[model samples]
Target: MLNGGPASDDHERLLLAIEAAGLDLWENDLVAGKATLPATRTFRELGYSREEVGDTLAFWLEIIHPDDRPAIENALVAYRDGRSDNYRAEFRLRARSGEWVWYANYGKVMSGSVETGLNRFIGVTFNINERKHREEELARINRLLSAQNQQLDQMNAHLEMLSGTDPLTGLFNRRAMNECLHRLTRSAECEAGVLFVDLDDFKKTNDIYGHDIGDILLCQVAQRLQSCISADDMIARFGGDEFVVLIHGRGEGGVRTILEAACERILNILGQPYVIGDLLLNACGSIGVACFPTHGTTVESLTKRADIALYRAKRQGRSLYRFFDSGMELDLYNRDSLEKALRAALKTRQLELRFQLQVDRNLRPIGAEALLRWHHPVRGLIGAMEFLPDAVASGLVHDIDNLVLENACATLGKWQHDPELRGLSLSVNITARAFDSPSIAPAILALLAKFGVPPEKLCLEITEQLETRSFVTANTAITHLREQGVRIALDDCGTGFSSLESLKSLSFDQVKIDGVFIRDINTNTVSQAIVAGLIGICRAMGLQVLAECVETPDQMEYLLEAGVDGFQGYLFGMPLPCAVLEAGVRDAPQSQRG
Candidate 1:
């Protein structure tokens, strides 16, 4: 209140500025050992009145948040000891309303030393609560985003796993398998091997039992295959009835033994009966093995070589295993060459039908079986054993069958007027592929009509293996041919699957005993018994029985005693050209006539 002088005017101006800024001023008098707040407006804003302003430092610290008290005390001590020239701190203080407000406190030591202690300190405080609230909100948002990003990372990892897996079997897919093969080839410590497994005749199961049962069978097969392998081995479904197994950490010598053992194990497991719904089904698999840096060095090469080996297994007969060899490549080349040549042979008339005479029990000629012979221009004469498999593999067996049927019917037509060859029956072998054709019966009937040959003079021979597939169509074909007066014979009986079942189900006029049983009939009791049993079965089924490969006199005598109605073998005559058979028939003695 009072001075009109310049110093008083400056003090008044400063007080007015502090009030306008809403700041509270405080001071500590070290000499007097006391602290004071001259204006209490800042404290009052926190619900503390002017009467509540404390005179001591301890009383002032009591209002501070317990977590903030130590920092403010430390700052005051640092300024007083001359370690710091200013006292600055930001902390929370409690209000009378039980709320907390952030305060930024700043002060400086006016007079003090290490020897005398602090003489005075002056400070001011301002509210900074709004800024602190904004900072805390930003920190909370950052934490939530971090948590979300972690969950997203986990989801992405699961999606990646799903992409590389087969959904039905839970095995790795081809893409994942290729990646694994690449990784194996890149490594140098151990050699790797690949086994290509194909389930035998899986498509037949699908056709007979429906796709649902087929799918269940595939899943069961996957489980069985998994059990056959070790934990370190990798297996993958290469799509439809095919699987690939990757073998690791084996040397050349051990790899073959290991692969063979694994293949045998897999075969045994797969061969066990599978029960789907109420039905039990039997299945088997064929495995082809190829090794790293041996059969091939790359994924493509190894897989291709393994596939080639698989083809060889199926060709040799299903439900077996084969290793990839250098010779297999030559075999493939030869097969391809043979397929091309056989196709050309059919087109160029290089294929011929030779006739082998089938004689009655009295050794009189009753019929002739037409055999296909391939006369390659470069390779020379090739029998059915040499080129027939290639023909089947190349999808040309049906065409070859057509040619043979056409030529046989034409030959029979020419012999119709010959006294010695009249009423002689001609039997033509039919391939399984021909049975798959819906027009087979009509085609053969049309050929017989075109050549003016009687239906009773022609016979069709099919192997026992035809029973293994969908036989409904084949049964229909057989019935149609029989209705037209053509006879059906089950060829190579007792050498293939379910011969008796085939005879019981299909309409067959005759059953020719395979050469295997006849080859050792005289020396082996088992062969004699098997032949006798087959003959009895055929007689009971009302089917004619013929014994093939009757070479020795003992074989013929034993077959004659066994009541075989006809015989066909080298003992009678070798397969001859049409002119030779005609000459032999005309020149034969009268006693030889049937």
Candidate 2:
């Protein structure tokens, strides 16, 4: 029934509420089969204005989408029959504009309970067309993504094969080797031997011929190693220039013999020359052998011990082999002890700088290179080589390097007062760790400034190790040092892979020919030729060439004839304390000569 007297005010307020909430109010008289008047907002929002819409309940139901009509009808019957607590639907209505617009409706029998006769059904609806469109688009994208993920799963399956093999040499990669070792050593009774092979000076070969030649060498090495192992045994490229061979079955002594033979065989085979792209390259390998049950029972232990033996072999010289021994374990303890002592050496004043004099071709002292010496109470005088590697690994080398820089600068300061020493330069060995560091140039410059030493009077001797470091970083440091008039020399040239690259790319005031070449320069025609070639190249580049390990006058005379600008070795004199060297050079300079 329509509202009487005061009810009209309440009805007007209800209409205001509907308009404020952006909602359309509607009512259905189910007993009469009539819906809300066509003038309602629901019809206006659908572009029908009022004339196109009808007031009958059947006409309102007809506007619902065909697919949604059944559910909406079922929901209405269920609610009216007391089967559902309420009536709600999301459906689309056909608009006068010929497009279907979505809506949401909630309704209730407002006049009476479901069990009693109901007079009227009331509901509110709001347009939901934009929300429905977004949901549909999201569902479509999800279907596409699901299909793409299925394709990716298939692609991932194909990449699994590439993981087990090295791309360059097609050999079993390190991960594959690890898996193989796990399978082989599952039983403790398994008897096997591992030979860890590292190619000697392969890095230098790369610097000389490029990575293409390096890859060829690795492939050839892989092939040669494959020849040494049986089908049952496994061979893998362990990474870098290193390879590993796993051999199975061996009697106690026979196994020992077999393992030795295998190591020697591998060394001999890899030592042969290779013809790589019109270049005849000589390559050698060092093998470290570790037998199962003898060196270790597990894969990790065996490989680790084998690597230690490999380090020993490399230290012994090129083209060598060494079995894992108990002494190498002792060396670990010794290294720890040496590092502990080094940490304290600086404070105890036991770390001293001994100057090895550098002489011109005329045999006159031009400068001296400072060599770090650790005068241990028990070990006597420990050479830098004995502990420097540990120092570098332990990060103690930077402090040690700082000490050398300060001492050399201070020595230069002292020489400024003596006319005989004023013209001399002091060379300090800066390890790659110190030289490539960002602070090295500033630290050296600060020290020189503090000591009032002439920049030209200080020279930094760096090995080819810097070549393996960031080229830009090392090159920048060199530029900074040389820009300030300090001298830079490449030490131990021809001993490492990057010497050629370093000499060619970086600016150097001098290049020191390694002692290896000078030691046999007289009889070794190869050494003579290399030395002659280096000298000629240095001269052509306008770089001063210096030779180390000059002992005999004949060796000195040979290097001098090769146009070497300077010499330093035992032939000139042993490394001496600055006080003794200064006193002797001032006193009997001739007597100081060896």
RMSD of each: 8.0, 11.8
Off by over 4 Å in 2: 1-327, 464-470, 520-524, 588-594
The regions of model 1 sitting more than 4 angstroms off are 1-170, 210-212, 230-232, 250-258, 361-364, 413-422, 432-453, 464-476, 494-506, 515-533, 550-562, 570-572, 586-594
Q: Count backbone clashes in candidate 1.
A: 0
Q: Which one is best on lDDT?
A: 1
lDDT of 1 at 553: 92
lDDT (Cα, tens digit) per residue for candidate 2, span 1-594: 566756888888888988899888778777777875442777777776555566776657778899998889888888878798889888999888889999888889889665667768888888889999999888888888888888887777756667888888888888888888887778676778888999976876786568988998899999999999888888888788999888886556666787887887888888788988788887889888888878887779989999889878876765899999999978867877888888889888899999888888777788888888999988898888878878876779888888878888988998998876787788888886565566788988999999899899898888426644356667888899999999999899887668887887788999999999998998999999888888888988899888888899999888877889999999878999998777656663663332
lDDT per residue (tens digit) for residues 21-88 in model 1: 86778777867757754436667778876557666555567778999978988987776666886888
lDDT (C-alpha, whole model) for all candidates? 0.85, 0.83
Who wins the TM-score comparison? 1
Model 2: worst 10 consecutive residues (lDDT sum): 463-472
TM-score of each: 0.65, 0.50
